[model samples]
Target: MQRRLIASVLLGHYLSAFTALGIPLYLPRILADLAPDAPLWSIGVLFVLPTLCTALAAPLWGRLADRHGCRLSLLRAHLGLCAGFLLAGFSPNLALFVLALVIQGTFGGAMAASNAYLATQLDKDGLARALNWTQYSARLAMISGPILLGLLTAQGLGLELYRWLAPLPLLAFALVLPLPADRPRRPARAAGSATTNIRLPGDLQRLLAVQFLFSFAMVVTFPYFVPYGEGLGIANDALLGLLYSLPHGVYLLALPWAQRRAANPLGVGLALLALGNALQFAIVQPEPLLALRLLSGAGMLLAFVGLHRCLSQRSRQGGAGRLFGWYDASGKWAGTVAGVSAGLLSQGYGIASPFLVACVAACAALLLARPLVACPRELPA
Candidate 1:
């Protein structure tokens, strides 16, 4: 049963990751199909709109999951994803494509739901391991999804086929159906529970803020890397795809080492992130940029795993869904802001400016993470 549960969770993570990345991976191609003459800045708006919707919707879904059940929430999210992707695939114009993305965001809370469900089944150590593995799956998807989409687009398969692949998550949802169900944890006093205020710890709040900054920095720079590389006179699609994926590949490779570190992993991760982003300003050549991207990927993965582990430890008391929802919202909101900012900054300054902005944001996060680093580690429950 445990093996089956783990398998199901990992599979779900992979599918979810695939669905999340599929569109963005082929955004350039999709944009060409929707609007051949669209400016690079418009791409950022495409990202911003859906992420803004997600920022608004994720918390609601999380609260619903806490009141109801994680499984039901997961199922609903997957179905929504299916419908959203199908709508995107059939979309005739950029406006309709944007609407499909909004639908996707409105119905999407699967990542938080999955994490919340797994939290119920695992102790601190197990939860950390599960979360890291899930992150690993996501990183793997990030690596493969773009390359796969690139290859398919090259083969004349078209970007719509990728959008049509939304059923993958639905299949994953079906796979999860036989896994043990988790009932929502009802508070001791129902009426009081509904009315009572729950506050997050100072450390968690700081951590979430740090997460927002880091996410903002990442989202701001990530979508523009292709254009940045193109500006550098490297137009080979495969090489560009590899360049974009290098960080995630390195991130996936670095997860186990991150999971093993005991002392100030978050600090270490943040420092690495700071260093990697700072180096981006110096590296203009393709080879050096690739190496720097790899470094950034490893650092970002370590930071992510450390932060998520901290969140899982704190959320063990209950309401995991709600907490993860807020966590997701924080990142999504940050991404929303970053998306718009990416467009403006790139338009006003230059394409490479976002990387410098990312570097500063990462340094800020590193400073904010100091309090978390000082807290004594807790044992698995």
Candidate 2:
């Protein structure tokens, strides 16, 4: 039972992780198809679509997770996302492509089920650490998914390949069938209400705000980054992939350490995210380039891992999946706005303008959490 539940819960997340990374691998292709002549500023709006869907739909999804439990959520979302991604493979028009992405976003809420499953089932102290490890699976997927997509891209795999990848979520839904049902308890306010207010409890509100600010600040690149790199003498899309991976590498390296040492661990997460954003704002010349990007990625790793751990620890009774649903949803929403704004800002001003915004947003988030950073719990967890 334990093994099945653990695997079932863990497997769905691993699948989601790959899908998240895989989208970027095909980003260049998506860009070419939509706007061969489009300015780099357009990338920000592209980044926003799924994010907007997630932002709009998360609380409702959380409520759904509370009602349907992990199994139904997975089953229902499996069918929807299956349709969504399958359609994405065949989207001839840019509008259809955007619609497909939105559909994918709507079903992304299935992740709430996975989090609730973990929060309800895992032991405390032990679970947060374990959750960190689960997150590590996502980083690991970053290593593999891009490489896989790159290989496919190199071989000229196009829409057909996406059609093939479309089955993965369905397969995941099938694999998790063995995981036993765990109907986690929820606060009456969180569960029974017909409407889910965007406003939440104070702690949840703070956490959500931090997540929003964190993603918002970092999203300045969107489509503009490739051009930024091109200006910096980057050769192709592959380098961009490597740049994305560099941040994850730093993040994976920081997780265990941050999980162990950071005070007001969640606050540390916000601070690290701030530092990363600040670096982008600070560096104008490409002379100190590689090191600055690396440092920023490390900062992000710390912030994200810290925040995940804090949320997992705090939601011991209400169920991990449910709490995570809110976390994932809020983060996605923020990411959407950031992506759009980044693109528009680049279009309206220069690419450099977005960095200034990133720095400002990140700093604000860090300050918000400063008062709380001093209270981190000790680590039997």
Candidate 3:
């Protein structure tokens, strides 16, 4: 029964991620098809607006998950996503498309709700394992979504196919109905209660800071990787696609190893993140750049899984949903900032300069992470 529940949750995560991310992967193509004369800045705005809305909405969804139930929250989120994607599929203009994204962001709490549910169902070790597996599923979706889009586009059915597939996540959420119902376990404290006003642990605050910095660093170079690669003289569309997916491939491969033997996982992950970004400076060729990206992917997966595990364990007292919500929001906010920064750095400095900024941010996150890992918090049994 537990295995089945886990499987269902994993499936839900994969489908949600696939649908949410897949369309955006084709944003450039979608815009070109819908509004051929749209400026490049429109792409950035399209991405940022949804993310901003999501960042704002995450906390409210988290609180609802905590007050109501994880299962219900997941259902609501998935349903909203289904409707949002359907609207986006039929959108006649960029304004309507942006509205669809806002709807998706406002109600799509699949990732946060899933994490909260798993945190409740499993012990610390089991939670870590589940989180890693879910991360793997998400990474797989990231890799496969783009490929699926490419194949469909090749058949000249890209936009139409995306519209048709928009509600696929709704089918995935149907599987969630068979899983055990998640009732709210934590009763709300009365207003002005001592516990209600209590602050987050200092270590948790530092951990969130690390999350923000790492997210910013990762996004700083993410939107420009293809352009940077092109600047490095790799012009083949297929090769560029391969380069784009290589990090996720490396992350999938490295997950098991990191899960098994990552004793100082947070510290080690941070160090690897810093190292990977630093290595980008020396890679002037495509071959070496590929290797650098792979290494960076491994580092990213390790750090993210490790930190999420740490946060889950620490917040297990009943605020898991809220904590994970904040976690998601911080990353989204950082990504928003990073997107703008990446553009400015790319424009003013050079295409590759954002990587230098990313390297610095990674290093800063490493420093912030050290104190938290040194004094690890204990989880309740």
What is the TM-score of each predicted model, taking all chains together? Answer: 0.88, 0.81, 0.93
Query: For residue 175, what is the lDDT in candidate 2?
Result: 73
lDDT of 1 at 177: 83
lDDT of 3 at 157: 65
User: Tens digit of lDDT per residue, candidate 1, span 177-248?
Assistant: 887777776444546355323334546678779889888867788767889888877889878878778777
Query: Model 3 Cα displacement at 69 (Å)?
Result: 1.0
Candidate maximizing TM-score: 3
lDDT measured at residue 132 in model 3 versus the true structure, 0 to 100 = 80
**184-243, model 2: which lDDT tens digit per residue?**
444445566774322233466677777778877766654467676666666667766667
lDDT, each prediction: 0.76, 0.66, 0.78
Candidate with more favorable, higher TM-score: 1 or 3: 3
For model 1, what is the C-alpha lDDT against the true structure? Answer: 0.76
How much does candidate 1 score in TM-score?
Answer: 0.88
* Model 1 pairs in collision: none
Candidate 2 Cα deviation (angstroms), residue 318? 4.2
